[model samples]
Target: MGTRLVPSGRTATRLLQAAIGVVLVEGLLLQNPGVVVNALLSLGVTFLPPVLARDWEVRLDTRLTLYIAVAVFLHSVGMLGFYESVWWYDHLTHTLSATVVAGVGYATAKAFDEHSDAVHFPGSFLALYVLLFTLALGVFWEVLEFGARLLATAVGMDPILFQYGIDDTLLDLVFNTAGAVLVALFGSGALRPLVESLTTRFDRSFGER
Candidate 1:
């Protein structure tokens, strides 16, 4: 089953990567700076999984790679007018992005707990940490969107990031919490090996220093 999924995951990732490139080209041709910037950023993010696997010698699951690619690809696509055109698109992207954020929080906490003998985190604490960390990031993102809109307005240009309203911000946080809770509950098993690999690399790097 793992082998079968690996091929399919790789195929999906490749397709998403190609789609991102198409979006980049579209943005370039359309002379849309916002879309082009988003596509470029998303392109960089979609490559991080493979880059981390190669550089850190971490054997990341292909599903994780595909997951990251899908999140960024969807965001880049959303920048092409789907946020305003399709109502649910923003929520979907927010949920997906929140999952990624939660994963990062979980990985960092696990890595620290494993790497430092004095710093220990209980399972319950880890879950709380992930939830809080995700919410904090969600808030920060909303702030960024608001700032972008303000700056764009001052300059008389359309904002690259939009803040819908108080309601949408609250909903985004709710979905962010939902994503974080899922990772807290079920992410440990899937993320364990990656965390171990990262801890090992950190140990080696610190020891060498």
Candidate 2:
């Protein structure tokens, strides 16, 4: 895999990509330009670190990143169309959507990596890891939404409040945790080996061997 670094050119390229994403969201996707821009900006910030630190295996990570980008973009499109007015509740729903997407993305990446023999972590351990990671990410996303509200308020933009009550946030955490745990538990057993065998076969057929 190539080294992950925030090369100046790459950063510029990412920004350009983000700009193009904004255009697509606004045009083809029929989302508000402002909403699309906001979502893309957030996405760019989230992805920048991985691109710079290059901590993840590229083959799997690239797919994970794309999944996240598309999910977030679609979530933003939905919010813009449905909400029309940004409320705290709207923000909370958006956060929920983002968290769910991210959790699924991580699980998918782990599954693919295991199939490809690109990485290995014990199934039991991976289950715990996924649970913990999902919970941590839930908290992290809340913090991000809070920060976004603050930034918007500071700039005299409409303040998006946390519409979901504290109880709702807790519920979201529970659901997010459940989703990851379920995937890890079911996926790590018979599914992992089967997937690996299939992937091997497919790769062999295509002269990847």
Candidate 3:
């Protein structure tokens, strides 16, 4: 058997970007407003890493950039029937998305802890804090999903978001917790660069003020 070649980070990113564009065109052809909107939004989000690096000087390495892109791409594709057709698609997306949320929470809080003398977090406490932060965002997302479904039903329009049920909601939260735990345990090392960058940015902004 021939060896398979793995794509480079930049190559994979470009392929995903092109795939998202295809999804956007598919949405337009199908006349599905929900898919169209989600695709458009996700396409915009994929550009945020470079934008932040350029405008804010908050640089994210390729891994984190690809992390965000993967989550956004999965969710955008889920809008096109994967959530209904593929059994674990929702779970996978939720877990991945939760990682992004947990990463942000950890990075921001850790940056603040490092940047401020008054704010201090022990390692254990920071881990717990990240879990709570992710869970809180997960709850908010579920609420938004439920609200969207309710509003759509009231208006007799298709819902942009879906609320599966209590069981699914609970499972989503469970997966979210799993993702948070992974980040808490292993993300600190991988996330150090981001934390340092954020800390520097915070320091500069405060110094200016």
TM values, all candidates: 0.90, 0.48, 0.92
Worst 10 residues of 1 by lDDT: 1-10
Better of 1 and 2 by TM-score: 1
- The per-prediction tally of clashing pairs is 0, 2, 0
Model 2 poorest ten-residue lDDT run: 55-64
lDDT by residue (tens digit), candidate 3, 39-101: 888889888877877778887767787878889999999999999999999999999999999
The lDDT values for all models are 0.85, 0.51, 0.88
User: Model 1 off-target regions past 4 Å?
Assistant: 1-7
Q: How displaced is residue 163 in candidate 2, in Å?
A: 5.2
TM-score of 3: 0.92
Off by over 4 Å in 2: 1-34, 41-57, 61-70, 81-121, 159-163, 187-209
Q: Candidate 1: deviation at residue 156, Å? A: 2.4
